[model samples]
Target: MTKSRPNILLIYTGGTIGMVKDFETGALKAFDFKNLLDRIPELKHLDCDIETFSFAEPIDSSNMNPKYWVEIAEIIESNYNLFDGFVVLHGSDTMSYTASALSFMLEHLAKPVVFTGSQLPIGDLRTDAKENLITSIHVASLQHFNEPVIKEVTLYFEYKLYRANRTTKINAEHFEAFASLNYPDLVTSGVHLKVNTDYLFKPNTKKRFKVNKNFDTNIALVKLYPGISEALLRAVFSTFGLKGVILESYGAGNCTTETWFLNILKEAILNGIQIINVTQCSGGSVLMGQYQSSELLLKLGIISGKDMTTEAAVCKLMYLLGQNVSSKVFKTIYETSLRGELT
Candidate 1:
């Protein structure tokens, strides 16, 4: 609401984008992102006012877990009112996971939280970090009628902005490192940045942002394979004291109709372990009951994941479990889309 400038927070959680070259050794090293203004001189030309905070000991995305997610959430929570928007510099490997976690952790958010990273070090001339970082900030600080646009968590890569949880890393060598097959790009870069206004979610600005930091990480993913046995199914289902399970079912959410396999899943559900049915395919949805192979799952009261990506489903389930909501409500809420991350 300030006329001077929108204060944007750049949270550097360590990634290729935050790396620089050690001239003597010519080795890539993580630099203090608090000196972001010194390295990215072009940032001064932007209209928005910016500030940064970096992890004390920068961690690669591979080491990311619930503990780190709590740190990021706490940072945002502590500074929620001070900044108009946020841009997270994170490793591409777990960016989707963190983004998905945040979408649920940060409830009723009315400001953009954009996550972007690069494949090459920022100090490299061939780096894509500059464009990704700059554009992500612009997208975060963007406003119309003095109201912030993109009031949700998103991942901007190449020239497309995707709902973070709905996306997955598709290629290693390509500049387009991520893709949201189940969802459309919220914005596309071109002669003029084209915003998908109709698809973009508009949060109720009156609602206060709430951070849900407590997450139960006791979750497991099981992928169905051909010739899989009852013993394997039973073992996978037996995650003692686990909070949730993401079952990566075959095409169209199809799983084996074998009695043992079905019984194992049925027992897990009965034991109060939340299980979500997601498809193994990258693009298609888990259309439960669409084929006979998956009919048993529907009959067993297993929750259909619909078109949710695995990343989204996992994070969502963790968030829901953390709240300790009743089983009935968890089922209802998990199937519902709060941040446009799922269908």
Candidate 2:
């Protein structure tokens, strides 16, 4: 049952948004969330009951990995019944990867899991942290007819809410740091919060909510370039325990039709290694057979990562590989959009 006032859980996984100035040392330090109201009194105005949880030690998003991703999944699983929604404070760097992993790991989501962070510390005079933090909680708290307005993993940044698996951190120096190229924003924040209901993911709430923690980190991401060589390909393919590869192919999923290159990929597949073809371009779908260069990939049965961000492809590969499914099942599911990740 939904509450009269949403009980929002704010999970701090560490980032600029959680930093504050140390008066004695003048160094940036993680702000204690126990004094959240004192730090950001703006939160008090939202019509919700807010609770806070912090990682035992802050992990920079650059240091985020599959184990930490599982830790996050466990936290949500343990608290799923108590909270209406969750807001994750993460470092902007690699935030999209973490978000995408969570989307796939958390099956049958029925509440909003809004991931957000800021470019500057919350204590800075001109910080963007306050707006990001307050609005994320408000977004998580939103309800209509006693049901959650958002029922998917999402990244709320700058002023837009995007499907987590579709997002990419596009800029480093700007306040607006993320973009969802192939997909549209689920919600926009301006004078008032505006939701694009048609774009929101409709989950199968009847299914039980659960978490998948066994992520395989034995995959590799290979970005193709104009002068990439056979030796380089051979070395990467030879890595021990390597189960899958996210091949960042050329525009429209094209790659050299050269026999040597194709042979290496062919050998990998024959040796029981899976390869997925994802576009290097940030804004297009990987239509495998659209061109002569990409046709071989179709014949080779390489998985097509249609319109999926590299971050999503990487995380999806990890999640699926961890499942220990047969190659046939893995390819079928990897090509399908389980979390609205690909168009």
Candidate 3:
């Protein structure tokens, strides 16, 4: 008897990785996915069947929005039975945001959905595209006893594989562009692939996979700075159609305890606006009640997005709002970890 090879789907949604430089003109142009195997001959060595799906009109990661997220989820849902795993080629600029959004959007995912892209174009002399693309495919194809080792949405960059929602793009010029500050990496690629099985997210095998396409984008992120004006704060809270706000407060979720500030926030909460307290610092969890400044926020129904990346908080708010979850239970659910995004 012969063993069957896994089938991996390669989704090209546009980015630096999909570009090739013209040798004579020195201009970059989109590379056709039809010639994928020819350009990267090493893919032929992988023990898996690969298929390609290119977006009709590729957009940069900056233009990435909830509609595109839904499109990606729909593609995976439509082909769930046909492919064993998926690799999404995206721009690194907003890759973390897209990855974070997808993590919540795809519930009960049991197969790998690996997102990867390079800082430099594929045709560049020092291009990181080939390695990132190849390694992501390998990571996506990984399985043990016919079950995938990584059964979640993950971002593969440089040599590290991080849970999608846990990652933040920390650099613009380096090949290593992302950092999973609060969570340990899932895998590290080297001479041999090393997977940290203990940190992997295990999905419920009994539940069926479903895609949630309804995302309410009526949200705002308010990053608190020293001497931030009351007018500015009021304007943000009063944004038309704003249903939720992710307040990037000072260290450990501290904010001005000034009476006016608290009143503004109190009014917002009273008007049914969900305010989530997330620390502006990169790596620490939000201990809302630890400081005097944050105590008022905690008492006034502010949800603590403990240690969750801002990207995850924004997407999670959009998802929860779309679910039309009752305002009474919103704070409890948002504070709790639903997709390993919060500690």
Candidate 4:
């Protein structure tokens, strides 16, 4: 008997990585998925077989939403049994958001779904697309004893692989476009792929893989700053059909100690609105009650999103709200790390 080569699927969702410039006209166009292997002959050198899938109409990551997320999940679900792993090519602008959303949308994921993109077009002479795309596929195809080594959603950028939900896009021009401040890189691509096995998420093998397409987008994000007005806060909290809000506060989740501000938050929570407290800083966990300002928020039932990126918090709230989780235990569940989005 002979061992079968792993089949890795390249899902192109559209981004800088897929664009190619015509030498004659200089006009950029989407790269056809059928010619993927032709364009990148280096792929033939990999031990695994490769396949490609593209959206009927390519979408920029800026236009990405819940509908597209469900589409991606459906693609994975439809081909779940056939492919060994998946690599999603997305735009760097909102890669973190899409990656985070996918983390929640795909439940009990036991295969790698590595999201990656480059800062330049694939046809550019100085492009980073080839390296990012090639390495992502390799990472996806990694296995030990015929079992996938990474069994979770991940984001690979520059030379680091991070847990999808833990990542945030910190730069626009630099090839190092993402940062996983709260968590360590799962793998580092240098002279060799060094995988931090202990940091990788291990899913329960017994649980069946599930695709969660239900995501409530009726939520808002509010970033607190000095002298934020009570009227502005009132309008946001009172928005019609708003089920949740991601409150990005100062370090350690501290916020205004004003009576008016506290009153508005209390009223909103009392009205059954879910409020999640996330830190505004790029790194650090939210420790409610550590300070007087944040203590009231904890007492008022605001969920502490400890060490979670705003991207993760937003998607988690959407996923939880879509499940129709009862208000009674929403805070408890939100605070707990459901998909390893938080510490």
Better structure of 1 and 2 per lDDT: 2
Per-residue accuracy of model 2 over 1-343 as CA lDDT, tens digit each: 6457989999999999999977788899889999999888889999999999999998999999988898888889999999999999999999999999999999999999999999999998888899999999999999999889999999999899999999999999899999999999999999999999999999999999989988888989999998999999999999999999999999999999899999999999999999999999979999998998899999998999989999999999988889888886888888888989988
Clashing pairs in 2: none
Candidate 1 lDDT by residue in tens digits, 1-343 = 4586888999999888889888789988887777788989999888899999999998999999989999998998899889999999999988989998888888888889999999888889888999899899988988897778888989999988998889988888888999999888999987777899887877777888788888887889888898988887677667577768899998889987888888888888889888899998998888878888788788887888888888888888888888888987888888888878777
**Predicted structure 1: clash tally:** 0
Query: What CA RMSD would you report for each candidate?
Result: 1.4, 1.3, 0.8, 0.8
lDDT of 3 by residue, 94-205 (tens): 9989999999989999999999999999879999999999999999999898888889999999999999999999999999899999999999999999999999999996
TM-score of each prediction: 0.96, 0.98, 0.99, 0.99
Look at candidate 4 and tell me the lDDT of residue 155: 97
Q: State in Å the error of residue 218, model 2.
A: 1.0
Clashes of each: 0, 0, 0, 0
Clashing pairs in model 3, backbone N/Cα/C closer than 3 A: none
Name the candidate, 2 or 3, with the larger TM-score value. Answer: 3
Q: Could you tell which candidate, 1 or 4, scores higher by TM-score? A: 4
Error of 1 at 228 (Å): 2.0
